[model samples]
Target: MSIPSLLSRRAALLAGAFAVAGLSRPGLALGAARANPVPLPSADQIRQDYQQMVDFGPRLPGNANHVKFVDWMKREFVAAGLRLGPCESYAYRRWEPKRWSLDIIDGDQRHAVPTVAYFVRSQPTGPQGVTGPLVYAGRLNPDGPASLPDFPKGSILLFDAELPKMHLRQIVHPHFIHVRGETDADVLDSLYHRLWTMPSFQMDDLAARGVAGVAIIINASSAMIAGNFSPHASPYKPKVPALFIGQDAGDTLRAAAKAGRAAHLTLDAQWVEGDVPQLTAVLPGESEEVMIVDTHTDGQNFIEENGCIALLQLARHFASLPAGQRLRRSIVFAGWPGHMSGDMPEAPGWALAHPDLMKRAAAAFTIEHLGASEWADVPGKGYAATGHNEYMNWPATAGPLNDFVIDGIKRHDLLRHAVEQGPGYTTGRVFHNSGIPHVACIAGPNYLLGIVPNGHMDKLDADLASRQTAMIAEIIKQADRTPMADLKGSDSSLGADPIAGTDSSKRTQCQAS
Candidate 1:
C-alpha cells in the first residue's frame, strides 16, 4: 500500500443458486436457457498463483522482479488464450531507499526510532543525513499553507496523517432541483478526488513554505507503513526530504516537538529512470460490445498480488470457455503499470489511453485486494487479529448483478464473514466517468495507505479468495446477459460522453488498487 514519493494514490463474491441468473431478469429464466455453467474459481489455483507472485519478491516498478512479473503476466494471458497488444512501454523516474534512520535528540538524551521510507525526487541525503529543530504542524488540508499558523522555515515540519471524518448527506441547492444523486458518477468522483489530493496538497504546500524536511506519524489502524509517492506526476522536484514513523515513534517525536527539541534524520535514497511495462489484452466475444477488467500490477507485497492472481484466475476461466459458450460481450484484461506511469496525459492509464476501445465497453470491472485477513481496531491495542475476506463496493448502477452478488454470498454461507457496500475505490472511475456502468470487487483492509504487510503469506484466506473470485465471475455473467441500456441509468446525468472528450485529463493521477 505504499505510493511512490511523488505520485501517491491510495489505495468479494458470492456463490449463487446454481443454473440461475438474477431474479430481475426473466428472459434467462431457470431451466429456460441452459447457458454453459460458469466454472467456479478454484482456491487451489489461486493459492498457486499467489505463491508464484510472492516468489518474485516485491514487484517494485522498474526492478527486475517487476519486469519478470510483467513477463509472467503476459505469458499467463497468452497461455489462457488471451491476445495482447504490443506492451505499452513507458519511462519514468523511481526511488530506491537503500538505508535510513531517524532519532529525536533532546539535549543529552537521544531516542532512536524506526522509519517508513517515503519517495521524493530530491538530492541525495548523504550518510550524515540532515539535522534540524522539529516543528509541530496540525492536520493540513488542500487549502495550502494558509491553513497553518506561522512556523520556523528551516525547521523540520511534522504532521499527523489522518483523514477527517466523513459526514455524507445529500447535497441540495436552494434554487436547482436535486435529483437522486447517490449513485451519480460526479458524487463518486468528488469523494475520490478529495482522497487522492490530500497527500499531494499537504506536501506541495509544505514544500512551498520551504521546510527543511517532513515527517508524518502513522495515525491509522494496522501497525503497517505506507510509502507511495509518484515523481512522474509532480511538476516540481522535491526541495526537502520526507519520511513516516510508526505510532510509538510518532508519540516520541511529538513529545520532542512539544518540548522544543531538535531531531536528526538520515534518508538514504536516490532517483533513477528506467523502463516499466503496462499490458492490455483482448478476448473477443460474439458481440461488438465489450467489458473491461483491470488491476494494478505493482505494490509492496500481497496487498495487490492477491488481486493479480484473481485477475489471472478470471482469465483462465474465460479462456477455458468454448467459442459458443463464451461471454456475449468482448472482455479486455488490463494489467496496468502502477505509480510508475503516474496517470492521465503525462502517463495515461489503460482506460484513458484507449478511449475508443473503452467507449465500446458496456461496463468496467476493477479487481483488487482479495483475501486480506480480517482485523479490528482494539480499544487500546491498535489493530487486533481475525480472519476473512473484506468486500467493499462502489457500484455505478443498480441491477440484477448487485442482487446476484449479495445472494451468491448467502448461498455460499459467507455473509457473516463479509462486509458488503463499504466505501471503496478502483479503476471504475475511468469507466464511470465515461458514462459506462462500473463495477468493482475490492477485498482486504490493508488496501489503503496505512497498509501493513500480511504475515509472510499465511494471512491471506485462500478459500475466501475463491469465493470472491466466484462472486465476481457471477457478476460478469449477469452483465453479459443483461442489456447495456439497463445499466446506463445508474447515473443518467453522465450521458454517453466518450472519456477522451470528457474531463478525465483533470482527474487525479493514481495507481488505483
Candidate 2:
C-alpha cells in the first residue's frame, strides 16, 4: 500500500480505538472523522532526510557547512509550503583550527604523542609552536585550592583528568525516570561534562600562574577523545594553548613529563568575526494563537542536531492537510543557530525579538538529539554500541501539558523514554522561562557532541525517530482540540534544580555536567 493509504489506515485504526475507549472530545472526534488525513513522512523518507543532513558535514555555527545547511533548510521549508519567517542574524568571533600537535623532546631523541582535540577558543600557537619543560601537575581539583609543585615560567603543565563514571541509577533527578535499557549498574563513562568544564574553570588560574601551555590526559581511548570538542558553550578565549591527550598516550606523556623532558605544543587556530542566521517558518492555522516548534541547527554530528530534519517532516505533514482540517492555532517552525557557538542562544533572542507573537503562543515544542543509539567506552576495547536506543528525556511543564506528553508516549509506544518536569536542556527552556507552556524531547548519547570518523551517522534509528515525531504530531493535534486554559493549567514550577536536595558532603564537587 502507498504511504498515504497506510497513514489513512493508521488514522482509522486510532480513531476506532478512541471511539472504543469512549473518548468524546470535539477535537478528537473531528480528527477521527476526517476522511483523508494528511500523510506523515514514512520512516524511509525520514531516513533519506537524515542522510542528506549528515552529508552537509558538521553544522557548527558561522562555518561554510552551517551556512549551506541553513540555506538548504530555507529552501526545504518553502518547498514544504511553510512561509519563510524572519532570519535572526548575529555576529561573533568564530574559531577555526587548522592543525595541532604535541611532541616530547628528550635531548636529541624526539617522540611525537597523539593529540586528541583542542579546547575551543584556546590561545593559538604560531607555526613554530611553543617549546617548554614539561611539568607533571597531577589532577587539578575543580572545587577548591590544592597544593601543587611550583613550576618555572615558560613550562608546560600536564594534568590528569578523569571522566565521571556514572551508573543508570545515579541519575536520580525527581523527574528523571529510567524507562528501560541496560541494567542500572552498567557504566556510563563517556559523559563529557568535565572535558570542557575543568578546562574552562581553570583557564584563568592557569593564565595567572603564567603557564606557557597545558595538556590534559583524559581517561578515554584515542578515537573517543579525538571526537570530543567540549566547552563549546564558552564565548571567552583563554590565554594559553591547550590540548587533550587521550588515555592511549597518557602513560607515555605522563612519564615524559615526570622525566623533565622538553615538549613542543601547538594549537594552530584563528578567530574570525562572522554573522550566523536563525530561521523561522510559519504555517498558518485556523486561529491566531500559535504552536511553535523549535530546534537548533548547529551541532557536531548527525544525531547532534537532527531535530531540524524532524521539524521539516512535521512542516510537510501539517502543510499537506486541507485548510479546514488544520489545527486551530498556527504552527511556527523555528530553526535557531549558534547552539554550539557559545554565544547567547538564538531561541531566547528570537522570543525577545517578537514579544507580540510570544503573547499569542499557546504552547511550544523543541526537539533535539533524536534517534540516538546508546554507546559507551569499553575497557581495553574502545567505543561500542549497547544495542539500545539512548534514554530520552521528555521534560514538560506541570499540568495538562505534561499529561498530554505522557499520553502520547504511551499511545505511540515510544519506549526507553522518561517524562520529566518542565525545561530540561534544549532551546525550549526559553519558552518555559518566559511563562509559556513548553515541552521538549532530547537524548544525550555519548557521541552527541563528538565529531567522529563515521560522523556518528550509524547512531541514528530512522524508525525510532519517525515514531517519536509521530507522537509529537499526535500531541499537537490533541492540544489544538483542547481548550487553552486546560492545556496551560495552573502550575507555576518551570523545572527541577540540578543540585537541590543532594547532600553537600556526598555530592560531586563539580556539578556542571
Candidate 3:
C-alpha cells in the first residue's frame, strides 16, 4: 500500500469510532442546542463546493473570472439568510507592470538577467524597451537583510532573498528593486503583473531618491511557478520594472553589485493601466461585528485548483445551513483578489480592520488548498488569535492534518494536539512563519482546512472538518447566551483553553505482520 494509504488506514483506526459513537470528544457546549444538535455540514456537500471552484479558469487578479467568482460568493451568503451589509470590501483598481527585465555578465558570460517585475508610477520612466548600462554600486548596508542602499539613476535593483521582507518591515528606501528569482518566461507570460505592489515603497518617494526599477525573486516549488501576486487596494500607481527572476540569475546582478561594477539591465515589460472589478459575498449572522471566512477569490494564473470555486463551495454550505445552526457571530464568505497596488493593507485586509471584532471574535477560519490528499484533523478551536492577533503560540504539532488546525482555530482549543506533535512542529520554524496574520503584540501577547483531499484527510473524511466547525458553532452558541462582551472574560482572563504540557513520546507496540 502507498504511504498515504497506510497512513490513512492508521488514522481510520484512531478516528473511525468517532463517527459511530462520537468524533474526537465533540467539543459541544452542554445543552447549548435547544434540541438534539442539528446535523453539521457534510463531505459530499464540501466536495461539491470544492469541485465548483475548480471550474473557473485561472482566477488571476485582473481577469473577469475573479469578479464573477466574487459575485457568486455574495449570492451564496445572501441565500444563507445573512443580513448582508455593505459588501465588506471590493471595488478597487491596482496597477500592473507590463514590460520588465535585467542584464548581467559574470566570468565573461552575458545573459539578460531574468526577473519578475513590479509596476511603479514614476520608476520606469527611463523609456520602456530601452537597454542601458547597469551600474553595480556594491552591496548597500551589508549588515541589512539582502539589499542595496542607493542606486545610480536608472539602475535596476538586484538583491538576494536575505533582503528584508518587502512590506513586513520598515525601511527608508528607493531603488528599482530587482529580485533574484524571475525569468524571461515569467515576464512574457505577463505573470509579473500581479506583484507590482508588494514592496509597498511608494514610487514617487523612491524616484526622488534616484530609484529606477524594482525586482523580486520568487522561488519555484518544483516545476510550477508561484503565482506573481495579488492586486493592491491602494490608489497609488507604481513606476519601474516590477520584475521577478530565478535564484541563479539574480546572483549575477548581486555579484556585479558586490564588485562595484555597472550592472546593465534590460526592460521588456509595459504598464497597462486599468481596473479588473472585484467581487464580494456576505453571509450574515446576529452581530454587528462579524467573523470572516476569508479566502482569495482569484486562482493562480498558471496553476489549477479553482480558488474562487472552492470558496463558493463553502458559501453554498453556509447557505444550506439552517439559521439556528449558524453561529451568532457573522461569518462573511469573504472573496478577495490577488494583486496589490504597493499597498500596506496586507493580505485579507478587511478582516484586519476591526480591533473589537478581533478581540471578541468567536473564531475565524481561513480556508485554502481545495484539492490535495494530506487531509487530516483541523487544529483546536482555541487557536483563534487572541491579543493583537498574530501567531500567538505554536500548537506544538503539525496537527493530525489540517482539520485539527481548523477546529483548534474555531474553538480556541489549543491543547489536545500537543502530545502528538513536538514544539517546532506546532509553531513550525517559529510563530509568524506558520501563520501570516499573527498575534501583533507578543509582550502582553495572546492569540491563536479542507476539501478534495483523499489519503489521511479522506480517512478522517470531510465530516471531521465539519465536526470541528460544528463544535465551534456550539461554543459560539454557548457564548451567545452570555453578555455580548470581551472573549478574555471580565478581568481579562487567560482564555478558556489552558497551556498544554508536553506528553513524553509514546512507544508504539508493534506486532510483526
Candidate 4:
C-alpha cells in the first residue's frame, strides 16, 4: 500500500532519540511473596532496541518479507544467548498482486491516465491497458454514495474513500462490519465505521447491484489499515476483479465516465495462492504452564524491502536479553501465518488439536506492530480466542493483545504513556471475539513520531521503545522462575501452541534470579 500522504512518503529524518524515563524505587508491594513486583528497565538500552524494530516498516502477513523476517529474527535470538525452542510454524494461505489501468476514447475526445489508488494486494507493478464502457456503481450501499450516470451491470464501478461518516450503529448493523455489542453504544455513537470495510464485500455489493469491474479509493483507513480482506471473502468468493484508485488519480476515471467517454480498464495481476511457510520459535522451561510471545513475521508483498524487519528485529532483542531470564513456563514465539489472506475461522488447526497445551498457559502476548507511541482506545475489555470454541465459550483473555497497551501500561507500567492514548475502539474486539485475553497495540499515528522510533527519524525517539521493552523484558524476564497458581478455571486460547495448556502437579515457585 502507498504510504499515507499525511505520513512521510520518504522515510525522512527527524532529530533526537526518545527521552529516557528515569527509574525510581520499585513498587513496595512484595511481602517475601513477589520479587520486587515492579522493576524499572534500563531506559537507555530499551530505546535503542525499539528504533531497530521501527526500521522494519509495516508487516503485512503472507508476503516474502515475512520469510526473510523469520530468518533475521531466529539468527538474532541465537546471538543473544537465547535458545530457540521448537517453532510451531506453518503456512495456510497466500495472495499475489493484481494491477490495472484504463484507456478512454470518447468519440473525438480521448484521455488515458492512471487512477488515484491503493491495492489490497497493492504492490508496485507495470500497468496493463484495456477498453470498455464504464459502469458507475457508486459507493458501497444503495443508501451509500450516489451512483454514476449510465451505471450498468458488467461495467466498471468506482468508489470514493470520502465515505459519509455514519453513526457506529450503521457501521455494526451486521450489514457493514457485522459487529454487535451491548456496551459500545458510546463509541458506536461517535465512530464512522465507513473508513474500513471488506473490499470483497464492497465489490460484491456493487456486483450484486449488477456492476462489473471495481475501482476503489485506496485510503488506508487512519484507524485500521491491516489489509487483506480474503478472510471475509473466503466463504463466498466474489467473481469480479477489483482495484483501488488514488484519490488524486480518480478524477480521470470519474471525468471520463461523466463525459460519456468510452471507459477501458487494464488489469495485470498475479494472484499467488497457496501455503507460504511461517516461522515459530520457542524457548522451553521446566514448568508445565505456558507463556507466549508472538508476532506476525509477514509483510506487504508490494513493499518487499520491509518484509520481516520487525519480526527479526524483535527476535534479536529478546534473544540478546539475558538468557538467564528464560521462564519455567514455556515461552513460544509464534509467527502467525495468515494475517492478510487468512481463513482459519475456527480455532487454528494447531490450537484445536492441542487443548492440553492451551489449558496450561497462564497468559499470552501476541505481538503486532511492536511499538507505536500512540494507542487507540478500546471499546471495553474482554478476551477473544477462548479455549472452548463450541457455543459462546472462549477461554483465556489475559494477554497483551487483548488489551493492546496492557503489558506496557499495566505489566510494564507505562502509566503516563497509557494516559497519552485516545479511546478509539480498535484491536481488542478480536480479542473478545476469539476469547483471547490480550492487548493489541499499533504504532501511534503521526502523534508519536518523536516518542517511538521513526517518530522523528533524525530524532529517532527510540529511547521510549527501549524503556518499554525493558519493562516487558523484566516482566517476561522472570516467567519460568515466577510462582504460578493452579486454579480450577483458566482460559488458555492465546496462541496455537500446545504448551498453553500444560498443567502442573502442584503450585511451583519460580523466582526470576
Q: Using Cα atoms with residue i matched to residue i, what is each candidate's TM-score against the true structure? A: 0.72, 0.83, 0.47, 0.57
Q: Comparing 2 and 4 by TM-score, which wins?
A: 2
Alpha-carbon shift of residue 249 in model 1 (angstroms): 2.5
Which is superior by TM-score, 1 or 3? 1
In angstroms, what RMSD does candidate 1 have relative to the true structure? 11.6
Report the C-alpha displacement of residue 393, candidate 4, in angstroms. Answer: 23
Model 2 bad stretches (over 4 Å): 1-38, 143-145, 164-173, 177-199, 494-513
Which prediction has more favorable lDDT, 3 or 4?
Answer: 4
Model 4 Cα lDDT, one tens digit per residue, 1-513 = 322234221111100100010101111100122232323334444344434544554333435545555555666654433343233333343445444455567786656554322344422234544445665445654233444555545566666654344554432222222112223454345434332234334344554666546666544322222222322223333445555454445666677667766665555556554344434444434454555555444433211111233334444444333334434454545444444444532124334333444455555444333333322323452211122111000112342322333443555433223211111233222322333333322331222211122323332233444444554454454433444442112434333222233221111111111
Assess candidate 4 and give its lDDT. Answer: 0.38
Colliding pairs, model 2: none
Order of models, best lDDT first? 2, 1, 4, 3
* lDDT agreement with native, every candidate: 0.56, 0.70, 0.35, 0.38
C-alpha lDDT of residue 311 in model 2: 90
Q: By the lDDT metric, which is better: model 2 or model 4?
A: 2
What does candidate 3's lDDT look like per residue over 1-513, in tens digits?
A: 212333323233433322232112111111122233324456665455544544553444555555555555555544443333233333334333445445564556666653333333333444444333354433223132233465566665554332223231111112111121233234223221111223333334444555565544433211111123322333455454444454445556566657754444444433444334333344434444444444455543211223344445444454455435655544444444443333323233433332333343443334333222221112452212222111112122222222233344445432211111222211111211322111110000000011112211222224433443444344334444433333223221123232232322222211111
Which one is best on lDDT?
Answer: 2
Model 2: residue 440 alpha-carbon error in angstroms? 0.4
- Once superposed on the true structure, which residue ranges of model 3 sit more than 4 Å away at CA? 1-63, 78-91, 103-128, 140-157, 161-227, 230-239, 251-315, 321-483, 486-488, 491-513
lDDT of 1 at 55: 78
